[model samples]
Target: MIKNIIFDFGDVFINLDKQATYKELAKLGVTEVSEEMMQVYYRYEMGLITTKEFIDFYHKKFNIAKKDLINAWNAILLNFPLHRLEFLKELEKSSKYRLFLLSNTNELHISWIQNDWGNNLYQEFKNCFEQFYLSHEINLRKPNENIYEFVLGENNLLASETIFIDDTKENTDIAKNMGIHVWNINPETEDVVNLLNRKEFL
Candidate 1:
C-alpha cells in the first residue's frame, strides 16, 4: 500500500513555460548558455551561491543588467491553477497518506511566485504538504540520488510505499530506480486533478 505521496512543484502544481527563460534570454542578447553557466545554474538551484552572486555572475559575464537577468530567470514561471490546490487540500483532508512536496527550484523563481500568488495563497498551498522540500532551501535537488535518499531518510519513508509524481522523466527515472513508484505526467494532456486515474494510490 502506498502510505506516502511525493509531488514535483512545477508542471505538477504550478504551470511553467520551460522554454521561456531561453527565449527571454535570447531576446536580451544572451544567444547561448555555456556549459559552465549551466553548472552555475545547478549550483544556484542547490543554494550553493547567493542570488546576488548569481545575478552578478551573469551581469559580469554577459554584460547584462541584474534586473534583466532576474527577469529572464523568472520567465519560466506561470499560473498555479486553484483547482490543483483544491485537489491537494482534499487529499490532505483525507489523511490517508502523508503528502510531500519535493521541488528542484531556486530562490529567485520562488520569490516571483510569492509575489505573484500573494503570501496568503502561497502559505495555503504550502500548508497542504506534510513536508515541503525546496532545492534552494535544502541545498539538494532532484534527478540526484542523494536528494531522494535525503527525503527517505528524513521522513523514515519506505521507498516501496511511496509514490512520486513528477513531470520530468529524468526525476521519475531516478526515483523509480530507487524502488519508489512513479508517475511521469505529461503536462499538456494530463491534469493533476485527475490523479484518481492513478488508481493504485487510492
Candidate 2:
C-alpha cells in the first residue's frame, strides 16, 4: 500500500523539450557538450555556484552574449497544462496520501516557470505538495542515494510504502532499487493525470 507519492516536476506536470536547450546552444557555437561543461552544469544544478558564475564561465569561455546563453539554458521549459493543475489540486484535496515534489531544476528553469506560468498558478501547484524539493534549492539531486535517503529520513516515510514517479530511468532506477515503487513514465506516450488509473496502483 502506497502511503506517499513523490513526483518529478518536469514532463510530469509542466511539459519540456528536453533537447531544446542543447539544440539552442548548438546554434550559439556550443556545438558539443563536453565533460567539463556537463560537470559545471551538475554543479550549477546543485547550487554550488552562483547563477552569474555559471553564466560567466560560458560567457568567458565561448564569448557568447549573456542574454543568449540564458535564453538557450531556459529553452527546455514549456507550458504547464491547466488540466494537470486541476488534477494535482484534486489529488491534494483528497488527502489520501502525502504528496511531494522532487525535481532536478536550477534557478533559470524556475524563473522561466514563474514568468510563463504566472505567480498565482505556480504557487497553487507548489502548495499542493507537502515538501517541494528543487535540486538547486536543496543542493541534492536525483539518482543520488543520499537525496532519496534525505527525503525518507526527513519525512519518516517508509520506502516500501512510497511511490516515486519520474520521466527519467536513471532517477527511477535508484528509487526502485531502494524498495520504493517507481513509474518511469514516458511523457511522449503517457500523462501524469492518469496516475490513479495506472496499473501500479491498481
lDDT per model, in order?
0.93, 0.94
- Cα lDDT for residue 67, model 2? 100
How would you encode candidate 1's per-residue C-alpha lDDT over 38-124 as one tens digit per residue?
Answer: 999999999999998899899999898888889889999999999999999999999988999999999999999999999999999
User: Which ranges in model 2 have alpha carbons more than 4 Å from their true place?
Assistant: none
lDDT of 1: 0.93
Error of 2 at 101 (Å): 0.2
Cα-based lDDT at residue 152, candidate 1: 95
lDDT of 2 by residue, 3-110 (tens): 899999999999999999999999999998899999999999999998999999999999999999999999998888889889989999999989999999999889
RMSD, each candidate, Å? 0.8, 0.7
Candidate 2: C-alpha lDDT: 0.94
lDDT, residue 17, candidate 2: 95
Model 1 clash pairs are none
